[model samples]
Target: MRTSFIKKKKNASTDVALQITSMADIFMILLVFLLKNYATSVTNIAPTAHLSLPEVNKSKGVIKETLKVEIANDLVMIDQKPALALHAFQFDPSEDGPGGVSPTVARVLNEQRKLRPEPNMDSSLLVMADQQTPYSTIKRVVASAASAGFVDLQLVVVQGE
Candidate 1:
């Protein structure tokens, strides 16, 4: 059986209108509700390959722009660029920072500070280290960055399970 709504008329066609006013209203309400409850501030930066951050429930703002330093077990990367490769715990003395610090990282930092002199950005350097990375290595990297004028450094970590 066919519905009469599909019938074609030579003169005025049958007036078959869909009553979507309520659906439109519902959709509008839903859009408004979702927009009203949307979070514009809190941002979550996901960890990349060869990097795993510790999960912790903490209220921290997202970094819009900053110099990133990633310290993995086998390599150290600055701003996603591999700065130095590590073999075991002992890094190449000529390639890394100074005493008890990352030499190559320190060199790279120094070069970056010399090349791009962003006084404000120099402070906000974020370090994303692996979970298995030792605390001492983290401290050394922090110290290296500090020596390179990066005082406001943040250690990024995962938020939850």
Candidate 2:
């Protein structure tokens, strides 16, 4: 036998409310984490004035922190200080020591080496040369750097698009 029962009354409020407090908390945490770890891995130093750096189609390897040797058409600077002057993209014969090494450049480099935390460690140098700089001038700078015990040399160039 089936029996009929009285129906229960329904609540007047039918809409459900969404609580976004937990979602807001998660969004804030993610924002702070991303901002804290943001980084830009690029060289901070700008190109010297009036210096046009060579452009390369493709560049390889990461840039390391090293002493800078900026070679322009008329001057050679070590760590932005004038080390020597270039006449016609060449050093004077009197300024050149044995094997085309520059005494001034070598002296400055040696002093920089001594100032380093570990003087005995292998030294690396960065060469930022103008596009108009001659090969001979670059060669002399390399020789001087070698005489000062800088073996690892890196050339700085602009990336071509």
lDDT of each: 0.72, 0.84
What's the distance in Å from true for residue 106, model 2? 0.6
- Tens digits of per-residue lDDT for model 2, 66-100: 78889987888888788888876789787779888
For candidate 2, list the clashing residue pairs, or say none: none
Query: All predictions: root-mean-square deviation over Cα?
Result: 7.2, 10.2
Where does candidate 1 stray beyond 4 Å?
1-46, 88-90, 93-99, 115-117
Give each model a TM-score: 0.62, 0.72
Candidate 1 per-residue lDDT, tens place, 1-161, comes to 76788667679768899999999999999998877766553233444448677777773755655677888878888876888786543366664445566666777988777666565455668778887887777777888888788888677766663
Worst-scoring 10-residue span by lDDT in model 2: 40-49
**Model 1 lDDT, full chain set:** 0.72
Query: How many clashing pairs per prediction, in order?
Result: 7, 0
Q: What TM-score should be assigned to candidate 2?
A: 0.72
Pick by TM-score: which candidate is best? Answer: 2
